[model samples]
Target: MTTIEVKCRFEAKLLRPAKPGNDKSWAFVVLPRDASEQLPRRGRTTVEGTLNGHPFQATLEPDGQLSHWLQVSRELLEAAGSVVGDIVTLELTPVKKEPEPDIPADFKEALAAAPEAHKVWNNTTTLARLDWIHWITSAKQLKTRAKRIDDACDMLASGKKKVCCFDPSGYYSKAFRAPEAENS
Candidate 1:
């Protein structure tokens, strides 16, 4: 197993800005671009670190605008007793591998029933498989999840490697989303 560790120490402001027409603000801590460039990979990376003396494990994601950031939920912020503009300390180390998302039971059955699709699915890369699972699980409604599973099997059997119209990196995906957009 190979391990790559990148540590960043900086003072960043915790900003809570609302998206246009959303009337809700999101809090996030932006990482400096230089620090971001030192990470092992872009996109979602499992990270363990400390924020204002509170330990946390989270996936660091790149917002389209910020390059990379940690979305500080209310619970996490409160745990650290952090407030906006406070200079919080961050020490992060990337995990060697990202764990796979759990496939829903119905989706597993759908794949099993389609041997051809299952074969193609078995041959897909781990990242590709993760994307398929993420797309299906991101559906907020049961009907949508069912439809995605069917669509996924069909696409896989047809030899498609990726979920159509889905952002596998999760920049715009519901599974992992950027806190805010510049065009907001």
Candidate 2:
């Protein structure tokens, strides 16, 4: 196994608030040692490092949770090294792994008929799928629910994974129209 070591200094300004949904204690940002290829590609690599003093490991995701943010342990860093502010430097190295296979076409075909929507949906991450399923299943009317499925499929085929009702510019588009508001 190939391993590289780096020395990092930690600063207080480099720390970010905990994620809204998790009990993470600290977060930091670190540039990948190798930038020739994006991190998280199949068989690409795993990054392991110590921030301040806390040890952490991170894997690359095609649609990464921490696209630009890196989570770390504040207490760990303070315990391992002296953190004066928000900046910290540490040694990091990448471990390679095999890539995952592409999604199956049959799975994609199971989506709604809107080709555009299907395309977008197929490209979205699993978390997006869970969110969409929850949203669609919560609808009260069968017709409304069907319409949501159609809209979702169309959006996916159109190369959009989210924001079904709006264009890339964030304007309302005729492509996706939600059901009219019910009379109060």
- Give a tens-digit lDDT track for model 2, residues 73-99: 566656766432445655544544322
lDDT of 1 by residue, 1-184 (tens): 2335667666677877555245443467778877766676655566777887788778777654425688777788889898766778887766666666567798899999999999999898766777788678878799999999999999999999877797645546445555553332
Q: How much does candidate 1 score in TM-score? A: 0.65
RMSD of each: 5.2, 12.1
Residue-level error in angstroms, candidate 2, position 166: 19
Q: What is the lDDT of residue 59 in candidate 2?
A: 43
TM-score on alpha carbons, each prediction:
0.65, 0.35
Q: Give the candidate number with the greatest TM-score.
A: 1
After superposition, candidate 1 runs with Cα above 4 Å error: 1-3, 17-26, 104-113, 122-125, 134-151, 159-177, 181-184
Lowest lDDT 10-mer window, candidate 1?
Answer: 17-26
